[model samples]
Target chain A: MTTLTREFTKGLWDEIPLFRIVLGLCPALAVTTTMENGLGMGVAATFVLVCSNGLISLLRNVIPSEVRVACYIVIIAAFVVAVEMLMKAYFFSLSESLGIFIPLIVVNCIILGRAEAFARKNGVLASLADGLGMGLGFTLALTVLATLRELLGAGTLGLVFGERVLLAQPFGFFQQAPGAFVALGILLGLMNVLSKSGK
Target chain B: MKSYLQMVLSLSLIAVLSGLALGGLNELTFEQIQINILKFKKIPAVADIYEILTGELSSEERMAVEEGLLSEKRYVDLGLNEPSLFFVVRKDGAPFAVALEDYGQGFAGNLGVMVGFEIETGNLVGIGITTMSETPGVGTRVKEKAFVTQFMGMSKDAVLKVKKDGGEVDALSGATVSSRAVAQAMDNARAFYTEHREAILDAVNETPGGSS
Candidate 1:
């Protein structure tokens, strides 16, 4: 149980997916145009991470050593396809909004990375805990970045559910490509500063 | 001999298991995937045109239009589904004019747009964006209702240039490429309408002509 706690907490900050490890960047940049998309992507990725990790851990001993990587890929791909199909059926608008990014989650390094580094070695319980923690960490990071971008770019927050808080006149540049880079850069800098300050 | 046999048996077993898992999942999701595809084909623009032209399209016509949207053969011939764009065109009740749209490749990704034009007069009745994937705050200004609304009633031959080029259109403040891409897509739709006017009209004029 103590180990489980450690595994989950580590992903939140100490080994943050986007800031510390910088995994799964394609969707990070592509679908994060709006706060809603960012949140949706984060949740979807988290679901894939938890399910794949748990399944992989269960089959760790069963999978042959020689073809473990291939097996892991198939498992991850299956989960991605499942998620994509489900999203399309139930959340058509979001599925459409996220577009190709949902299918592209198969290529996201974070899922494969966790499967290789943790799930393949850990027990089922430990792997589940790790998956949940890391997935949440990734989601949190994406949400922060997305919120900053959306708030500055559109001059509104919570545009997804139509809960808009008009903070200030939108700074148009914040919504451009350069804005994405700037936002990410400042976030990285801030994270580093906070970490160094022992917070 | 024993070790070699063990290796072969294990490999085959794994293969069989993996195959069964994947095949089962595929079978289960096949129907859902088909449904999603059908739903995608019935996006608002296509539905609107189909409704206007035929009062209410039967499920069969809808299925036809859905198939048409998914079919590569016709889209490739019309250049409507380029790597840069995906388009759908439908005629109104008179069958003399058709509304066409192109989803052009913008700076970041795709931009979906719709335009209605008269096949006979070559006049554009309306133009609007159904979707876009441009930079926020900057490129997304193209999606603004005001910006899209301006393209209404413009003549097909009217030079749809940005005001920077001494044309009537106003470019998005920080999204020149995206703005230009939208304009160019409209131009392509106009050219496509002109080039295929007679055939499109005839197709619309035929019984069961409307999109589903």
Candidate 2:
């Protein structure tokens, strides 16, 4: 049980998908322009990740070694399509805002990465914990990154809830595509500095 | 030899099951998704045009929207389902502005845009950009109100070319190609409106999905 707990918690910080391990940078950069966008993306990816990881782990022994990759991809893709439908049905506005990135979640490295590295070798419960932990970590990282960008870039935060109002002066430059990169770079650099100093 | 066959059988089984699962889920969610899309994307876009046309949309118009009677959407059945889709906004049983979505060639690739125009008045109502692949700051800024606002209230006979091209419209500073692409899309939509004005008006006045 301790080992299972360790497996899950490690994904939160030690093996964080974005800053520490540096997996799935495409949606990380594209959708972090707004807090809502980043959160929506993180949630969607999490859904696909958790579902795929669980299914792959359950079928790990049954799946042929030679054709496991193809099998995993099929399973992952079906879950992604399911996630897409649920999001479309319930959170239609969010689905629209995320746009092509929703379908693009199927190609996100984190889902496939966990499926290969952890899920295939782990038990179902362990895989589920790992997927949840990694997903939460991704969501946390995105929400933190988006808070910085939205607050600094646009001057007003809490626009995600739709009760928008101006609070402070904005840099405006942070709201652009270049701004997204610069902010991400700074965050990455900060994480590096903190880890190195701690070590 | 046995392992190879097992690999093939297992993979094929997974693929077949995935297909069935997806097919079943799609059936369950298709209607809700369609309704959500109309409520979220299409209605909001149509409402924006409606407000722009009449300055303010009435409570009746809002109710019409809720009742699914405020607008009509048409995908031009050109046999192959071309990128030509349109939304017709009606008031008092008459079509005010018909919004058309069309594509035009730009420097990057195809530039997709939507333009709403007053049918009877021959006045351009508004332009809202939908899908675009232009450069981020330069070309994509065509979506910004500064560039898009230039298209409002222009007449049908008025030349749609940019200022350098000897017309009223001003090209986006560094993204002239993107601006020109939007202009060309508007031109195409206008041409389509001219050709299919009668059919579109009839469709807007009819119930939803009752028109071609």
Every candidate's DockQ is 0.23, 0.86
Off by over 4 Å in 2: A159-168, A196-199, B57-71, B74-85, B105-112, B121-123, B131-153, B172-178, B202-204
For B1-212, candidate 2 gives per-residue lDDT tens digits of 99999999999999999899889999999988877766665556566656665665578876566455334776555444543456777667666778877778877778866778787786788877665667656798887868876777888887877777887778888988888888888888888788877766655554555333
How many steric clashes between backbone atoms does each model show?
3, 0
Model 1 C-alpha lDDT per residue in residues A53-161, reported as the tens digit of each score: 9989998887767767877777787788778877876777888889999999988999999999999999999999899999999889888888888887776676554
Task: For residues B174-198, write the lDDT of model 1, one tens digit per residue.
Answer: 7888888788778777776778766
Residue pair clashes in candidate 2: none
Candidate 1 segments exceeding 4 Å error = A20-22, A159-163, A188-199, B1-42, B46-97, B103-105, B119-122, B145-150, B156-176, B202-212
Chain B, TM-score, each prediction? 0.61, 0.76
Q: Please tell me how candidate 1 rates in CAPRI terms.
A: acceptable
Residue A128, model 1: Cα distance from true site in angstroms: 1.9
Each prediction's TM-score versus the true structure: 0.72, 0.86
